[model samples]
Target chain A: MYWNADLECVPLEQRRELQLERLKSLVRRVYENVPHYQRVFREAGLRPDDILTLDDLAKLPFTTKDDLRRTYPFGLFATPLRNTVRVHASSGTTGKPTVVGYTRQDVDIWSEVMARTLTCAGVTQDDIIQIAYGYGLFTGGLGVHYGAEKLGATVIPVSVGNTKRQIMLMQDFGTTVLACTPSYALHLAEVLEESRVDRTRIRLRVGVFGAEPWTKQMGRELESKLNIVAIDIFGLSEIIGPGVASECLYNTGLHIFDDHFLPEVIDPVTGKQLPPGEEGELVITTLTKEAFPLIRYRTRDITKLYEEPCPCGRTHVRMSKILGRTDDMLIVRGVNVFPSQVESVLLEIGQTEPHYLLVVDRRGPLDQLEVWVEVSDKVFADEVRHLETLEKTIQRELESTLGIGVKVKLVEPKTIERSQGKAKRVVDKRDLYNRDK
Target chain B: MWVKQISVFLENKSGRLAAVTRLLADHGFNIRALSIADTSDFGILRLIVNDPAHANRVLKEAGFTVSETEVLAVEVPDRPGGLARVLDLLHQAGINIEYLYAFVSKAGENALVLMKVEDLQRAVDVLSAQGITIQGHDVVHQI
Candidate 1:
């Protein structure tokens, strides 16, 4: 299933040698052309020449997302604006969008990695890929589109929305590969069930789902409902969009294309690199990016890395499923909540459906968290005391699990919105839009 | 005798109870007796209506989580110790009362106490054996 056999299975020593060369050249180029890198390097009392070996990468200043924001549109471009063939930006919900540029070669590298991503998911030229990731400013749709096209697969550029039409296209085109966020995949499966579309008619065999972290329970649910192997693809717009790494058919871990991008795990608190198999924030350094070369870019996504050789025979290092992001962690009354924690609890309870929404608000001086969960129809039909008992059980389990008091609201099925794209799990109306406010 | 009761889950919001009552009213449901059990976060509106099935279906269709429960409706004297005497009989029989609420009948003479117990059949049989007035559905509707 390897797309580029020679590059994907390159010998470890040869890969490291290639990485070192690319890293050195990237540093030198950024130092000469990008003013931000130059200033940061000088402030850190370092030079591009100091990074002779891979170990000296520690001496290079780490680039936070705030650095990218400060740089804005073209401040970090290693090449001139004319040489840049394309530009992409992150879906900036809060403030300014973090922009990135891609030269002609950068697009080629992105396409190559995407080809490898789809190939790892067992997609081929014969398969039709329906990319449901939203197109336009968001990179997901085009990222997967380029790779699927590069893989010689039939690309159905059916971006997000129009759920019924997507299903119809799946049946009409005999789509074999689905590319979208995992949440959208679940929503599509639900729509498929409601529409009474014959699942067997659509020849979907694999789903490349990413852009958000999803649970293994969700993966199983998708597999059973859609009758497809749901694969996780990880990427960020700043790095190169949806082709950074992908889980192979083995479904073990996401194998980072280390030759293209060097990956490291570091303790988010201390900003020190962690040993393999330690859970920490992911930091990436672009090894061969031309338009936007980043050095030790703090990913903020929390996960561990494994160096053990995978059965899939890809020599690249594999990262564990993204646990949660440091920024995505919600602190309620001093208790931290990752939406995945509530999701895991709901999955563990099993009596209720997996769909839930966490609504956090402030009442007077105390922060309140309410979990609106959809129970099974049978369970909802039971006695009110039983429903109350279920609520108490969930509250007790959550309080014990999250170490904070929570209120549980038993909602009817399908009351929570089914996201056409990434599911919005939390609605915090604490009114602290700004600290000064 | 067992009376069909409908319990609707209401979030502890300002207008939630009003909304449910309005929905029932719009559908022409005559609420015979009602009691609310509440906590800080939510309230359960336990209701006795003219048509339990119809009320439950309409409320459920309106997206309210409603469930049907069976409870005993007993005719307690309007005077003091009338309710206490029934409680004493139940206490002697070891029938644990989960909850109970009363409302004056149309005659404004006898008070009808709607009661829920852990063992419905046992509570009914124990009370009936002592010649207590247990109202059936027909009598409850007329009242």
Candidate 2:
């Protein structure tokens, strides 16, 4: 089931050798070309020769989102602007976006890895892939686009939006594979149901969903509603884009193309490397990236890595689903509330839909967490007592798990806005209060 | 006799009551009697509609949390102490009333009292033996 059987199924010993060789070359490249890495190395009193073995990567300083931001556009490019063919920027809603450049060969590498991504998801040349990730500076659209085309699959460059039209095209074109964010996939499912489009008419069998952190409940919901195998693909604009890693049909974990991109987990506060299977911040070093070769770039995404062989027969190490962003964690009355935790609670209860919004507000000096979830029309039709009991059950479970009191509000279906991209889950109103003060 | 009453759960937010009433009105469901039990955070809206089944379906379809329960409708004199006399009979019969609401009839000098109790059959028998007129759905709807 592996796409690049030669590399994907490589033995662990050879994989380490390949990673070490690539790491040596990458360290030399970044130091010789990019001033940022050169300065970082000088500050740490380390040299590229110091990184002979993979364990010596600890000697290097960690690159962070702030570092990328400080470098700004094109400052971190290892190659001259003339050698770069394409550039993609991260969606930095808070501030300036992190920019990444790719040479022609780098673009080809992206396409190759993307081709591998498609193959791992069971997509073939016979499949028609409709890429719903946005085009332009966002790497998702073009990244998935070129990869599908590389795999010889028919590519529909229909970027995001126009929900009804998307469904119509799926029916008319008999699209076999769909590529978009998981939230957008769910949104498309909702639109499909609303349009009453016959599911049998469409030929979608596989969905490559990513771009935001989602829950298993969401995965099950998407699979049942859209009638497709929903697989997760993990990537970031800083490293390469959407082709860094993906989950196979086995649904074990996402196989990080370790040969191309080396993955590591580190404690967020201590900045010390944590053992595999322990939850920590993900730090990735690009072993094959040319134009933007990052050295131990801290991705800020929280996850764990497992080195065990996958059932899919891929020897590459697997990473767990991205639970939440380190910055996205909410401290409510001294209790840490990860949206994923709330999602898991809701999923376990099985009383409401998967959609929810966490509202954190400041009540006087104390913080209050309010969870707004969508219940089915049938549950809503129950007696007031029953509804009260449901609310209490949700509240009790949340309090027990999150270690803080949470007010559960059952809202009407579709009241929360559906995103065609990343689902917006948390709304912190305390910031506004602080601003006013 | 027992009459079916529809109760809806509503968050204590502005325009919710109006929205529910507008939805029921839009569906041509006539309300026979209504009462609201309120708290700081939420409200329970209880209604006696002309067609409880049809109203329940339409309200539920409109995405309102609604439920149905059996409550008794008794006719009392419109004058003062009319409800007191009925309560005195229930007290002597050891029947405890949960909640009750009254509606003044335009066709006569009689007020309709919708009563909810733990035991509907026992309340009906006690009221019937005491000669209290337990109004059926037909009589209540007409009023």
Candidate 3:
């Protein structure tokens, strides 16, 4: 029922003690090794010996992706390049990709946490797993691959793309588990439906979907469409790869491996930590990462964290699926809008496709929010007024959800670009306010 | 009693309307009557083709958003008051016409008025009881 049951189900007090010890060592290591943390610590007037308990973690300066970028390649890595065994990076859309290094020990810990994640999703070593996440600099493919391997499962490393072959191997290999982003999973479902393969022949039972913020509605859509229980596995390259937390079969909350990674929720506006159950940006502190140990790194993902006894009996704290990321939030006419909120509204309306693009443009002084939604066959009406009413309905729902008026445009099906990795849901054309400055 | 109207969604762009008609023409479809209801950004090309099922299937296969609706095709008097008389009767009967278009029948000066109503059966009954000629499904091809 458990992988590494002792650590997976460690008692709360014992886990806290272990975390404190690891935190102290990590703080000392960073202060002595990385000059960035050294300067940050000196600027904050702090010493490694001052971190006597977990609460002292708040005293440390927060790290961000920008900090990683400033460091560029291997700048923030605690250990020397000789000690690091491997490295993986995120594909930053604009700037340099955020780099993450793993020593031999760090790689082992990633596998350990990911193995627990798969186990939490009800994956057994006997199950044959198919990993479709792209395999290069991205952490998703190798991350899940090594974990599935560590779990002693038969792995079919069919990295992303080539939908026909993915489905063919999915059937031929009798893959019991499917791992990829939720958007890719939807694409698979569409192609699989058109392929007309015999569904009874494929042994697909569970899906591990992640790498982007997806609504529960999409999860339900995939579940009913694929006839498999879809699980959301959360991770970022800056932290560890796709195993920071995983949703159990209970579908309640994702059990965060808090013993190895300490998580704190802080108000994105004030940067003050919020108590449990209050949704805020997540900040993570790696307790066991050797090559790159971050102190209170701001994750920018908004979610509520809960510390309670899960029904599955895993002692780790649970976090809800990310509601939205602060980086993805749009400020339109003094109102904050998240694309996930728009997605939820569209899915709830039910006839439109889950894919949508939010275009924000400034036509004079006001920021105009325009949403492009794909009109599914079920929603297309024969009359002009029929479609106009649909547009108005979507506009009203989006207005009520986002607390601001928005223009809704119904586009034809398959018009919006389908992404193979993280789906691009926004196009901001508004010029920067400070550019003139 | 009823006629099938193929309504296609088209972007408000030049050559898009041509594209739809050309595709239908390539497939040997005869568009008997058509009206385009357009806005600033898009338009709905409502067509009354000789073969609506074939037209709809063809348009959809060509990646055009197509929808099928049941509209009543009535044979109206060719005079100036011909169409208004039928409309007056429908308005008096409390039957709302969501939209309507007309085309002069080739067989006579009389025109065929295609009216799309929310209640197909109610509109047909109201018009029939008032002595109006509601054309059959094959009326588009014949007239």
Candidate 4:
């Protein structure tokens, strides 16, 4: 077996000590094997022995996305290529792909973590889990697949697309657990409603969704539409896969596998770690990852961490859903704007879909914000004047919500490009320095 | 039987017109006649080009949103009364002229007046039966 399930039943204090011991040995192994970690450690003039306890982890040098970009492909892997069983990469839309490697042992650990996550979500051996995340290059599909199999549940590797067939399988095959991104799950619910399929007739009872940040309103909307309990599963390809953390039946916050992955919130600009309940960029350090052990890797995701014990009897650390990426912030006319803020406002409007594009450009000395919103056919008549009025309404709502005036452009339905993977929500065209020269 | 014209939306910004004209020059499309209708915000630049179809496609591919419409192209003698006779026929037919611009044909025997009429087919028939030639081309090559 990949994991000792008995560890879940063990005392929390004992698990921490065992994890610390394992982390120390893993740190020593990486120091000897990985050149990048060795140079980083040596540059800080720190030895592996200096990290005696988990608290001493702050002394280690932090890993940034720029570091990952610098070591593009397999430069960060601690193990040789022959030992790596699988390789997954993040969609490097801005640049090259950020690659991650997993050894056989690392894969086993990942499966165990995912299994624990699914079990906490109440998925059992009797359930048929449909994995709907896109497979290949992206880690969501295969990550959830292994976890469901590890839980002794029948795994249906129904990689994303063909929504009609997906729903048919759910109805015919008696699928109980659905794994997909939250946006796609909502899209499927919309599709189900359109097809007039009786939502209650489906056997789906629970859903595990992640890979993108979704609001609580979205969760409630999906729950009402599908009549299934929606849970969040959080992970990145840089860290293990989609099962590194997951929400329990409580649905409050996602429980991190603190024994394997140490979570820290740090000021993104200063690199200073923050206390619990303080929102900042999340930093993660691997405790037992053998192939690619990262120490204090800056995730750029903004969220708060809490260590309070959950009602589910797990003492793992809980992290709120990510608010937004620090890099995704847009400066419109000297006022900072986040796309998530726009999304929240759109959700409040209750008529627009989550699809929106932030078009930023400079008009003379002032920055212009044009929000291209896709309107459904039912809500909008096919007339230019009506669209203009609707646009004004959206603009007014956004101004009140964000405290910044913005122009809204109501686009036709299906105008925005549907992304098969990560969605590109922002397009900024203002470059004053380049323009002046 | 057919006449084509190009209408370009020009923003009130520096070098905007130069960019559009330069693109046409590079593509070897010659401007037969052009007119500009302007407001404070933007200008509608209408053109009677040597080749409208090719010009429209080229301008569109270069990221300019371009559309086409039919206009009456009347061949009037290079004299005053020849122009007055065709306008009289259109007036008698109750076809309103929104706006128009005239260009001297390269042959110089006749002048071509591009007319934006309320009814295109009726104007074409009215001018043709009155013994005035309607200069509509299927294809006009670059000069």
Q: Number of the top candidate by DockQ?
A: 3
TM-score of 3: 0.60
Residue clash pairs of candidate 1: none
Query: Could you give the candidate ranking by DockQ, starting with the highest?
Result: 3, 1, 2, 4
Which stretch of 10 consecutive residues in model 1 chain B shows the poorest summed lDDT? B102-111
Model 3 interface DockQ: 0.30
Give a tens-digit lDDT track for model 1, residues A193-220: 8787776798988999887666777788
Q: Pick the candidate with the highest TM-score.
A: 4
Candidate 2, residue A178: Cα displacement in angstroms equals: 0.9
Off by over 4 Å in 4: A1-6, A9-12, A329-437, B1-143
Per-residue C-alpha lDDT of model 3 across residues B1-143, encoded as one tens digit per residue: 78888888886767888899899999998888889898766688888888888888888888778899888888787778988888888888888888888864543656788888878898889888878788877756655
Model 2 spans > 4 angstroms off: A329-437, B1-143
Q: What fraction of the true interface contacts does model 4 reproduce?
A: 0.00
Root-mean-square deviation of each candidate, in angstroms? 16.7, 17.0, 17.4, 14.5
Which parts of model 1 have CA positions greater than 4 angstroms off?
Answer: A329-437, B1-143
**Cα misplacement distance, residue A175 of candidate 3 (Å):** 0.7
lDDT of 1 by residue, B2-47 (tens): 8888987766778888989999999998888999887665667888
Candidate 4 chain A, run of 10 with poorest lDDT: A428-437
Instruction: Write model 2 residue lDDT over A177-237, tens digit each, in one string.
Output: 9998776787788777777677789889999987665567768888998889998898988
